[model samples]
Target chain A: MKHSASVLALAMGLGWSGMAVAQEMKAEVIHWWTSGGESAAVKVFADQFQKAGGTWVDTAIAGGANARTAAINRTVGGTPPAMMQFNTGKQFDELVENGLLNDVEAVAAEQKWKDKIPPAILAATVRNGKMYAVPVNIHGQNWLFYNTDVLAKVGAQEPKSFDDLFPILDKVKAAGLIPLAFSGQKTWERNLFNAVMLGQGGAKLWLSVYGDKDPAAVKSAEFKNVAETYAKLRNYVDAGAPGRNWNDATALVIQGKAGFQIMGDWAKGEFIAAGKTAGKEYGCVVLSKAGGGYAMGGDVFAFPKTKDANTLKAQAVLEKVLLDPTTQIEFNNKKGSIPVRLDVDTSSMDVCAQKGAKMVADKNQQAPAQELLTPPAVTGAVEDVISSFWNTPGQSVETFQDKFAAALKSI
Target chain B: MLALRPRLASKLSAWLALSPATTILVVVYVGCTAWTVWISMTASRMLPSSTFVGLRQYDALFANERWQISVSNLVVFGVLFMIASLVLGFLLAVAIDQRVRAENVLRSVFLYPFSMSFIVTGLVWQWLLNPTYGIQAVGRGFGFETFRFDWIVRQETVIYCLVIAGVWHAAGLVMAIMLAGLRGIDEDIWKAARVDGLPPWRVYVSIVIPMMGASFATAAVLLATSVVRLYDLSVAMTNGGPGIASEVPAKFVMDHLFERQNIGLATAAATSMLITVAAVVAPWIYIQSRRRRAA
Candidate 1:
């Protein structure tokens, strides 16, 4: 009996050590992609991770702010997830600064992300000479999604620039269709303002106001033009615009009741859900006359600091799976975004995404979005100013400019 | 020493009985409040830090247009909502107290709105108030092409829309409280009033209202609490829009705390709200205690 007991102990010890060598790579990922298309997009990453011999644990909270809060709380409280999603911006800056995030420098270096990813995006992911997040996709935030049927009926050509936009809008309004499908919430209001700033004010003024934080740029005549143009477009929107969701506003365009909507590429998800094809039933353009650039905003996954060896292995594998060229195409295609890596083939994506990819490929036209440029506090303050300006018809452009400058100066 | 031992044992048992409540009050309530106040004075963002920034956050809060609008809007909403809810609820209770038939059914109907959450109430009101596909559209469909009821979409009138929904939601709760108060009135009071040939409204205004002070206080306190924490309603209804016109103090704090990542500002706003409530309630509490002592 004593000899058998000794043999059994030895067998158990060997089994435990053998299991450690082939430990399970289980990654618990927290994200906000709970919608139909968003979930499908996320499943691509899950499937690929599963194929890579890892388990994908999804904790999809419905709202971005809510999911980030849960993930941040868990991380700070020391029981962190293997990975978490953040918008590709300063959302996770403090996490990185406080060393709560593990730098993915190894996988990033292996993939040569610096040579492949756009400069603006690569800069957003890298901090303190190390990459702290793996950027997954690039969403063009300033796209003009218009109804082709409405434009043709109004005898209006698709506008290539802001100069032609007013005429088309006027024609559509005169034809008794809603000229602009607008969502009046503060976020969309700010997005519309950014679209105008990027298209009309050009990239130089865009960088000056947001990136350089130059007060003079906000007070310039060029900015005044952008402000006046944005306000004028407000006249084209119907009274029902306020408090409407972005997808509902997109529905107006889809039904041909409205002419166009200035929204992100994600709006295409709504159109696609309605069985509308891009460039046919609806049209899309990144409107610009000069210095036009795609306003790039997207998602990234950051690995929370964990001492568990299995978790570390999971993070490394998930990072590679997230940015693999094929994974990028599959994920972003369903996500209604372009691949973050510019070298990938975007042939399978629709025309709108293809256009966005081409625009992203040009290094000169790569404009990082407002979130990439400013902290959330500052962006929110500026957004409040923009919403007030948009909704208040009597406010002068000069007064709006001063408020905008003051908002930009806020912390 | 033996006689004192029995009293001492009872005293120890009393302390043991009260320990859990006292601990919860100290740790959860007082402890968190102290932490929040400390966090407010620091330059904290998404995460709390120990670097103190004095009253800089308070200064910023005072300067913020959104916060200023929030405070003023709260005052407006609080005053209107409280008065409207109390008057409407009192009238409803009085109506039902007139020996009306089907009283139970009517009571349930009146109290149904209270059972639904503010989120549901706000959504229902939003749909009913919207201009395009809501009431106005219905009116237009009836060939009233010029019909207009677009208060929810307008900035100036949006807070009033919130008041309307709030009063609708809370009046029912107030009605139930007032009805119980009315039922608690002595039978002899009504009999004496009838014998004295007093009209119902005069009796209600002069005698009954003055006597139901506890009920009025209870309803007002409930409504006041809701007014201070008026977040989900505004979020569900206008989302502080048509351009931050319907913003409230609680929504401002929540936005800064989470979405905007400005914990210092959020906590400062929260602390300011606490101070404001204390300032208002302190005098009331002092007067109440003095009145009770004199009686």
Candidate 2:
């Protein structure tokens, strides 16, 4: 009787294992969006995937460099995750070239992504006439956020150009408030310099400098003015600015202790977390005189190649779910970014996000951020030069221009 | 019969015990180092491939301003951290060896920092040194409104902050080693010095230090290796910043390898560091071996 009972249990276990193998579609995804807002944003995709009969396994790493390193190392070691996240730029070019990633042309064609996605983002995700990654949202990298009460207390109007912005900064300074709440890290310093380049030098100069890698453009008189304007704003920041995190800088503006913070649209997440509504508690403007030449960068998920049928099916499901119109809206709403699809209804988002979505809809106003234009190596080297110039007070503009040109030449 | 074959069996067991470590040393250590040297000569980026561009990466690395700054900062940090830790460790060891009560507690308290990782030490020091919410703020709150201690935010003096944290983390280990050496000294030597009318400080400076050569060498080599691999403390505390003011060689290599996606340049930097360490260490090792053979 004991032997017979054991045999029956073994038979049931074998049958359950067989059924599990045939039906389950599990995907393990590695990403670097682990913050409160970012985690909520990623859960939207996980829920949508689950509702579509797939199991989502989330592996969240905190920093972008760390996550990419782990993902690439795992891919090389032959135990790759089903999906991995990278910046929506040339970061994944090597993965695609090495045949480590699976192309999602089937989903792209089925969803009519070629028409729905913006051409710039589509160009970034596509290489060699194949779609190897899926872009989820667009983040504007050059938005100027201001506290409404502080600006009103100082009787300052929103600056329409860099020329008008400086006097406003001065008034805030004279009113015993920090004129510009700035984070003095290298990346944030580079972000501010890029904003100045676009706002003061225009898109033509930006394309010439970063796109063409033109030595003449770096040495041009107009570029000198851009550098000077960026350097001039260094006077407005407090001494405690060095090594401060971006969110902490945003906090100064939120607490009405500062007038302005030039950061990305992601700053809106901090404001929302602090219960401050956009356009009332604070305001945002993309600093460009040419309507809105918004500087754009974003996140993308690329599927790693796998021969297993179950994993491939799971990848297909994820590719479709990420670009679904409803998923796009829900994900970007939590992420504080505009949806990648131009046709999504963004009216329910904050006023800043709506403005970004409207700007992205117009092709003429879209300027690719520096990461999309140049590789990380070149961008990082130039960032070193810019940060050094900003911190070293006695460094001249000519010396900075020479160093900037030299940095570009090395690449 | 078993007792008669014991020597032969012991010889076989010795070889068996040593084989695994030897194989690992040859394959993992020597093999990876050789592979890195070969890759440094190529123009690899984002991934390693065999497309040779001999010496160009080295030329670029030498010409790069960041690399130059890192080399200079490493020198400043290495010298200061080594001397400061040695002096502090020796003093602590001597103080704790004076037949004090609660000896075990004192030893553990002195050695606690070494048990904690450098990341934790760096973070603790970073908070204590921060201008807004740290020592400076506390000082100002005490009615000293003009007090300032913001070296971590200044370009010129940022590297000293790293030196401070590095010495604090390492001095404990040195103290443990030195204390062991002190306990092993002959008790008759102290009696002899006391009968000869020699002062205790003089005996320590002139006699005891010269006899503790092995312990000093051990502590110096340990501190030297830490200085060469000093990446995490700088990363956690200042991140080579206030604008590349405290950049070190290991951090530069790592940033290029993973973050910048320029593996060729990263490997080239690593190779340069390897050559420098070998240049400094090879002669010392050779001289020590010769002295041992002569003795």
Candidate 3:
């Protein structure tokens, strides 16, 4: 057989995710959430679904790309699982178009999913006027996490804007700790670069380059300055960052070894797992004062078409359990995200998640995850350029500006 | 009916009986190879669509900082890993032939890696190689401050880490194969060498090594297959990071096929890989058949 092409190519050989399900309606889901916290969080859904008279089969694959491949292959191989997870974006657009996915419109209509989910989140799950996936949780794609002790050591307060961020980063560096605990993976590097562009370059520049592909905006002096500032972040990371995992980078901030990590809200889970209190041991903030925004992405489960009547029933049951408001809150609470339902109570969530929930609740501050704006291929190729510049000592900002503009154009 | 030699007809019938497997081999292997080559000629994205941009992907593949590095890395890894495993395997096989103690234990130690899937073992190697969390960290704890085993992070030497793990997984199986060949050898040769006072190393190197040709061929084919299919190790260990320094062709093809969704470029890469293998193996196989014919 022709082998698969995936970043999480069981070539990545990491995750296979079922600690909780392997019992009821016998639904085997392949997912990438194999980390300690992620596994525990998914347990909520497993338990709830089993209670509703179904069997759960956990095929716990660690990386997202790996899980998707296994699911896709099995679906094609005539033994499709009841549910498979995907990031709420355009990733599964082709699957829907190819008629490989079963629409959950029956469940969506009954739950009035349209009114509960934020518009952007709903748009990602629904394709061509039909709901193809069920949105379970909302992940705040961009949030700034800082070591309160490290910030205090450097006499820096929570930075409200990118301008405020730069000086504080320098002060954190002067305090003899890493100013930014960056893992330096291509995607993360590009994300940090984009964050700075949005926070400093502002939304217009962000959209002009990503949405409009305006070569003029890319060639501007402001774009040059954004590149320079992103380049500045290079010096803040430690030498051991080239292949460091994102969680380990967050650990540096948690242990007071670093001052900042402009990562997703998932960093809070690492902090909480380490027994650190948010806003006390560590503090949270989002940059960009033109308006505060959360780059929104979330997890969704899609049903691959199955011929077995039992599997079909299990699929429907999984959809109902995943979208139930109570199950949604419990799952997202442990997952370091928020319920997709804007109506869910936020009092029980951690301080950082509360901030994210508040951001989603306010219509003015919702920004889509970069996945919504671009496809996986373009993002990955551009990420390569970003990681290269961040790692190489002599890469010029001007050269990078040219390459970045060209990358967006070509992709 | 015209009378024919029964033996000749029986031989022909035997070949006829073998046609199904051969047909499958030709169509599945040969058919896919042609499709792969054709796709490479296109500029297909997520799916195979004919948007012929002749040699654009090839140009990109060549100019790609990652692809170039992948070639060099594979060359280095393949040469060293192949030679080392063969040498070490032969030695272990010869030693085991001398009524060695705990043969099974040592054999299992070496052979177990091959049996356990590389997906898991590659992960294990990655963990063991990580400087902070693995052996280096443990060594420093025991008062070895001068310890410096950090190949996993270095751009210059990380491929060798792959070589190290690969050899660990392969040498044992090679040993078993070689042992079988060595045992099949006539005891008369060893007895004659003893009478002549030829040293053991000399006897082994000059006569025994040369005689174990079939085993060497088998091992070579096995190792070559592994080399071509190399993916799990690089992905689990470094993921072609530190700026595309540790990239491999298989990993590149994989990124295109699934992650990047550039199926055309992936098939192009696959097609070229197949061609390279054919270039090397076809001639060898032809010459081998000719030799067998003469024998």
Candidate 4:
């Protein structure tokens, strides 16, 4: 009798699993969005997918590189999750080339994503004339986030350009506050350098250096000026800046200990988490002395190829849910980025995001980030040069420019 | 014939049991190594491709400034770490071997750092060496306003900080090994030295250290292996910061492998490391084997 009962229970479990397989659309998504704000942003998709009668399976990996490596390995190993996340760039280029990823062309065409999403983001997803990934949001990579209280304490106004920022930084320094809340890691160093390039050298030089890989562009006087500006700003960073994390630097600004932090729009998530409203406690701006542009980078979910019918169905559902206008607004609100779909009503987003949306909508202001222009290899090579220059204050601008040109051409 | 049959059966079973591990060693280690060498010659980026580019990848790797820095940093770290660990460990063992009080506790304390992972040791050292909140801050709090110990933040001296942490973590293990060697020295050796009117330091230098050759070899081999695969400590402590000054070969290989998405370069770096290790080990291995044969 006991054996019969055990068999019966086993049969029931099998029946339930079979039922789930036949009836439910389950998507196991692997992503690196494990931060508090990032997780909340991802939850919007999960809830929306559930509302659309699909089950959401969450696999939150902590680091971007680790998550991508795991996802790429699993996809290659033939036991991939239903969907995976990548920074909206060439990270998934090989997967697309190898035909390991399924094209979201059908969903994209059906939803008219080409019309809704920005051309730059759309172009990144559409490799070889077919959309292989779904861009979810656009993050402005260069935003000067300053504590309003800190600036007010120093009797400084909001700096609209890089030229205006130096004097404000000086005032902050003279007042005994850290002029720049800086993270001294390689990635942040590169980010700060890029911010300087976009603001001082303008979008043309930014694109020429990264997009064209132009050696002459690096040798130009504008590039040297940008290099000099980045070096000059290094003077304001504290001794504790080395090996510091990005959020810790952001925390310094939030606590009014520092005057400014040149970071990505994702820093908004930190401000939101701290319950400090933008324009009141903290202010955000994109500085451009040369009529600069908004440097855009963001996340995308690429669906790995699968023969399973239910998994394919689940991917389809996820694609639509990710791009739904309302969902896009809601997700980006928590994500600290603008919706990839520029047509969406963004009044619900904060003032910072609204400003980003305005810049993204303008053709001239829509600057592609370094990742979008160059592959990870070139980006990293250039990043090494930037970091070396930043860390070594005595390095000359001409040497930096020469090194930058060499790095750009290294790959 | 009956006795031979049982012995043969036992030997066959042993061979059968060893087959799996032997197969794994050949396939996983030797096979993957060959594959890495092959991939290093190709124009592989995010994934391995068959577009062979000869020694182009190696040329690029050598030309790369970061790679050069990483190689030199590894050399500096490896030499300093091994020598310091050996000297410190030997001293600790000798001090404890003097039949000091609480010898058991002292032995455990010496071996404790070895039990902690490199990551933990690195983090603790990073905190201790941090200028703002670490030793310098503590010194300033005591009114030593001119105190300074910020080597970890400087590019020129950051690698030494790693060596310092590496020595701290590894010295204990060395001490344990040396202590065992010291204990194994027959008590009669000490009595003989006393009869000859040899001082303790003289006995240790002339007789005991030479006798502890095997112990020193064992400890050196362990420390050398750790030196070659040093990744977590540098990662945890500095993450190759201050403009790639503290970067090492393993970190270079790893960063290129996944983050940079340049498998060809990564594999090339890996192959270079393999060749370096093999070049150093091959001669020593041959000498050791020749000596064993002579014995």
Candidate 5:
């Protein structure tokens, strides 16, 4: 009887080892992609991870700030998820500095990300000579989407410069249509200001103000021009624009009630959802000028530091699956963004995405978005100034410039 | 062996039972408040560090235009919200106390909004106040072509819109409290007023209101706390927009704390709020305790 019991114990041990070998690698991923298209895009990553013998647990929070807050709190509270999302910026710098995030340098080196990823995004994701996050997609934050029918009806040429834009806006207004579809929320207001700053003030001044933190650049004549131009747009927007959501504003353009909207590429998702095709039903312009800069921002996932071997393995699997070439195309296509790796084929994407990809391919025109350039605190402070100036019509451009300079200086 | 006394044993057990609550109050509340105070004096960003920057964050907070606007807006919102809610709620309670038919139904209808959250309240008010599709457009659709009620989108008058929504949400709760207070009052007081030939309005204004001090204090304290933590309403309604027109101090602190990653500035703002509330409440609390002792 003793001999048989020993044999049974050995058999049980063998069975347990076999089970461990085939155990599913489970990972909890936190992200802010809760919209229909965004969820569909995130599902691509989940499916690929599942196929690779990993479990993808999703904890989706709706707002970016809320999701990041939850992820950061979880990390600090020592109940961290396997993977978490952040914008492709310096948002996760504290996590990295505090040794709270796991470095994915192995995957980055294996994939030759240093060579493939765009320089601006590569610089943003890399810190202290190590890759702390994986760049997943590139979103152009300064696209001007206009309704083709409205423009054609008004006999307005596609605007090629700020000088050209005013005439077109005037014509659209004269035609009894809302010239600009605008959301008066703070973030969207900031986005509109950034578009004007980039398109009118040009890349040099944009970099000096946001990147180099040059106070003089903010107070410069060009920046004053940009401020005036942004304020001028107030006349074109309807009185009901304040407190409107970005999608609602986009809906106005889609319904042909408005002529133009300066928004991000994600606005394309709304237009597509409304059964419109890019370049046919609506036209997308990165900036008015041909060589204008495209403000690039996107999302990335960072692995939290974990002592569990299984969770570590899952993180590795997620990092690998997220950047796989096929997964990039599938994910970005649904996400209304271009692949972070410029080598991906653009044939399947819409014309707007194709245009963004082409613009990103030219390294000279790739300007980092404000989040990539400044810390969120500084960006928020400057946003307050810009929005206040934009809403208060009586505020002079000189006062706006001084306040803008002071805001940058506060950082 | 010596036997323990029954009273001593019970007292020891009571102390043991109360220890956990005392510990939590000290650690979670007092300890965290102290930590926040310490952090506010430093130039902490993203995460709290031990770097001392003196009163620099406070200085910056005082200089911020948005912060200034948020404070003034809070004052306007708080005073108006408190007065309006109390008056409306008292009136509601008085009306319902007249032995009305379907008393239960009337009470619940008056108290329904208190059951809903501030987020729901804000969203409902947002829709109702929207210019393009809400009341204004509805009025225009009904042939009132010149009807205009777009205050929610305007900067100067947005706080009043918030006040309207705030009063609407809170008056129900106040009504319930006032009604409970009125129900608890002695029947003898009403009989005495009638014997003295006092008019109903005079009795209410001069006697009932003055006698319901405890209920008024209760409702006022509840309303005051909500005023300090007026975040979700502003977030769901205006998002501190139409260009920072409807921003409140709590929203500013929250934005700086998490989204902007400026913990020092956020704590500075939070500490300032705490100090202001204490300054306002400390003397009143002292006077209340003294009055109770005298009584």
Candidate 6:
């Protein structure tokens, strides 16, 4: 029975993943990619690692935070897995400081990651002038996904900036469709607000607040305008927005009951689930008011230090397969992110993804998500302020601005 | 000495027999509690460390808006839920004791909910409570146009829906316990009541209800623990949402301990809960012991 399952797992390898190789080296990878598409994408890595004579022990927790806590606990308890994922951001900062992670400098050097991977990504993966993690795919945060049928019925064109976004939202309301589908969970609320900030307040405001943590910048009239824009979006959402999952909101757009949703590129999963194709059934662009660029964040796997020789070998194989250009393309194709490598092919990717890849290829257009810029604690604090202002009726825009400035300044 | 096997234990032997249990109690229960209390004082994050930050975590904790909301929501939920459960439970028990036909079937009707886990029931509640596809829309579909049952989505009324679900999940256990107490009553009570020419309701309310002290005590303790350890219902029902209108302490502790990666704050929350529980339960224990002594 075990042999039959192993054979099935081998045949199911997407392209170059392991069945033959995995039999030799066993590596436990703890991650949070448990949804259908996410699991399918992860299987690519597992298969590739297996093909390379390494075993991929998949321990997938459902939620990102749940997985991280488990991984952190295991590492601290001195029974760490071979490789575990962290967002390419400040989440692993404490762990790195605590010396719980092993430097993946060897893999970086082997893959010429410094040359192939984006500087933003490399910078995220590297801390203190040493590589400590492997950068995988880049998920374009802040994409505006819209149902074409709903938009056409309302006789509205795709809005270029958020100014164009509002009138269309009104039209969507008049059409009796959901104006803007929003998931009011804290993380996504913050995501939508940040998208508005980046699109409206522009890259400079984003950098100052997150990258520089300049309180003065957060207190500026520009920041106030961003806060107002973020709050203005509240009126367009349905009453059922609060506590809804991102996918549920995405489902609204997919079902054509909602005209639009401002979400990450990963929202493409919901569209795909409904058998809708991008550019044919739906339209997408980065929902920037200032027309800057897509905000990018993605997954990264860091190897934990281990005494087992087999574990070390498995980590090496997994790293190789993840960064291998073909595997990157195949994985991200199913995963809905651009390949981490800039020089990858664009022919097979959908139009929106191709656009994202092109924008990423251009040096001036790539802006990292706050994950790549700030600590989760700081992001969580800002999220609270954002969600509060968004949810509460009769809330003063000025009060929101002040609190927003305070949160940014403190961070 | 007259038995087939001689009795072996004396005072020294009894001590030997009890050594394992005593050691386990000290090492497992007391030791874990002490460890949690100690960790509450430190500034640990993803992992435990030796940095003593003293009440700083707790200070931050109290200042958190969500935590304050959780405490308030819990107070409202706990009181209303406890009273509603007891009342409904007692009524159901009394109804079942009226010598109705299909008594077992009727009891099962009241008791079946207790057999199911909160996770399954919470989902059913969530689906049934959802505005678009649930009771509200269904009622509207049936041509009752102005129907509005959106308490699940509203900030103010979401807690009541939670109470409704909590009552459904819990009241059954209370009924079963109360029913046992009711059934154990002697026929002499009815005879005495008849001799006095008392009404059926008054006899049951005055004489029979007071006699069921142990049943009420058991039910209160069980429900009180559920009220304090109310993580699953909150999670399965509303997930502390519609902007945290339904947040509770256990969910807060579990979230911080695992998701937030702030073990210090989580432990602090746990220790505070332990203290509160101790304060309430200690006096009850004292009263119970005194009653035992008097008996």
Best by DockQ: 1
TM-score of the candidate numbered 4? 0.96
Output the number of the lDDT-best candidate: 1
Tens digits of per-residue lDDT for model 1 on B1-295? Answer: 9999999999999999999999999999999999999999999999999999999999999999999999999999999999999999999999999889999999999999999999999999999899988899999999999998999999899999999999999999999999999999998999999999999888999999999999999999999999999999999999999998999999999999999999999999999999999999999999999999999
Against the native chain B, each candidate's TM-score is: 0.96, 0.93, 0.91, 0.96, 0.95, 0.93
Winning candidate number (TM-score): 1
DockQ of each: 0.81, 0.64, 0.32, 0.72, 0.74, 0.48
lDDT, candidates in the order shown: 0.94, 0.91, 0.81, 0.93, 0.91, 0.84
lDDT of 5 by residue, A329-393 (tens): 99999999999998888889999999999999998789999999888888889999988988898
DockQ category of candidate 2: medium
TM-scores vs. true structure, each candidate? 0.96, 0.93, 0.79, 0.96, 0.93, 0.92
lDDT of 3 by residue, B1-295 (tens): 3456787899899999999988998899888777787888897776566778888777766766667777888888889889989988888888888887898888787777789776777788888887767888789889999887787766777888889888888998899999999998899999999999999999988998899899999998899889988888888777877667678899989987887777776887787787788899999999989999999
The runs of at least 3 residues in candidate 5 whose Cα sits more than 4 Å from the true structure, single-residue gaps closed, are: A1-24, A307-313, B1-5, B184-192
* Residue B159, candidate 1: C-alpha displacement in angstroms: 0.3
Q: Output the lDDT of residue B102, model 3.
A: 92
TM-score, first chain, each model: 0.94, 0.94, 0.89, 0.94, 0.93, 0.91
**Candidate 3 chain A, poorest ten consecutive residues by summed lDDT:** A14-23
Better candidate number, 1 or 4, judged by DockQ: 1
Tens digit of per-residue lDDT, candidate 4, span A141-228: 9999999998888888999998999999999999999999998999999999999999999999998999899999999989988988
Ranking by DockQ: 1, 5, 4, 2, 6, 3
Q: Point out the higher-scoring one by lDDT: 2 or 4.
A: 4
DockQ of 6: 0.48
TM-score of chain A of 6: 0.91
